[model samples]
Target: MMNHPVSPNAPTASRAIGPTEFRAAMGQFASGLTVVASLDASGNPVGLACQSFSSLSLDPQLVLVCIGKGSTSWPRIARTGRFSVSILAADQQEVCAALGSRGPDKFQTIPWIATAHGTVRIDGALAAIDCRIHDIYEAGDHLVVIGKVLDLATRQDGDPLLFFRSAFAKGLAA
Candidate 1:
């Protein structure tokens, strides 16, 4: 690698932006929404709307999602050692909102299916990625969960629900 001298005009205050500014800046980049779903000890469903799902390592079939530490649902799902990431379809904003908030009956308001492996999957989602817990790391206000993919399938064909700015968005051009 060739080394180049740092430009004298390089900006140094880029790291000083507040969270609000950072959030607003990040909002310009579109991202797909997903529900991280799992079953509890009694076979009841638990889930949370997660926007941070991404493919990590192709060789080991790994994926990752960052869950907020304040989320009430993640703890229950983490305990199960297995979960499914259901990529929300364009028509599932209600499903996203219901699972995103703190509630005892999130599953009661959403249409979902129970997997044979005991994970919960959203009904009519664009896709489902079932995984086993591989590792976890605490990062500031969130937990970075690494999952080893056991199975995955495309559930339906449609545009995925997206989150931009501070709201849910849909209908991206094909």
Candidate 2:
């Protein structure tokens, strides 16, 4: 057998990394939980919990969230061209689970109100940001959605809900 040269920073893989391993490895990086929501064609709220959200640009006030192609909410958000991201508070674990779970009307159980922009905002979140869809790009099995921020609100208090190693946690000072 011959050895293959690999970068020191890259994981040693005899074969292609499977989804489980990829997910596990990526989970080492802690991320804040967010609920990306929008109204469907029929004017009903739809949303999903996501960790792949981040600020992209300051000049245009741009942010982005990666939505899986399989997500039911993404289609609605794409059609509506508007969305709101609710950064979950550390106490809102139930809200995270509710929106993340499958085969249920997530909004039916969670407390949310429609914003003036026609997107749903999760109540009692750490912060809520309303945005209009700026652009979208296909990336592997997910779509990277860029948003232009329109309006935002924040509560002065509360820690953010964080995800790491496939579990939820509250941030703490070292």
lDDT of candidates 1 onward, in order: 0.91, 0.91
Check candidate 2 and list the clashing pairs. Answer: none
Say which candidate scores most in TM-score. Answer: 1
Off by over 4 Å in 1: 1-4, 7-15
For residues 1-174, could you state the per-residue lDDT of candidate 1 as single tens digits?
A: 999998999976767789999899988888999999999999899999999999999999999999999988898999999999999998999999888888779888788888887899898999999999999999999999999999888954688898888788865679
Cα deviation of 82 in candidate 2 (Å)?
Answer: 0.1
**lDDT score, residue 120, model 2?**
86
TM-score for every candidate vs. truth?
Answer: 0.90, 0.89
Candidate 2, 1-174: lDDT as tens digits: 999988888966577889999999999999999999988879888999999999999998999999999997788778988999999999899999989987558777789989999898999999999999999999999999999999999999998899989999767579
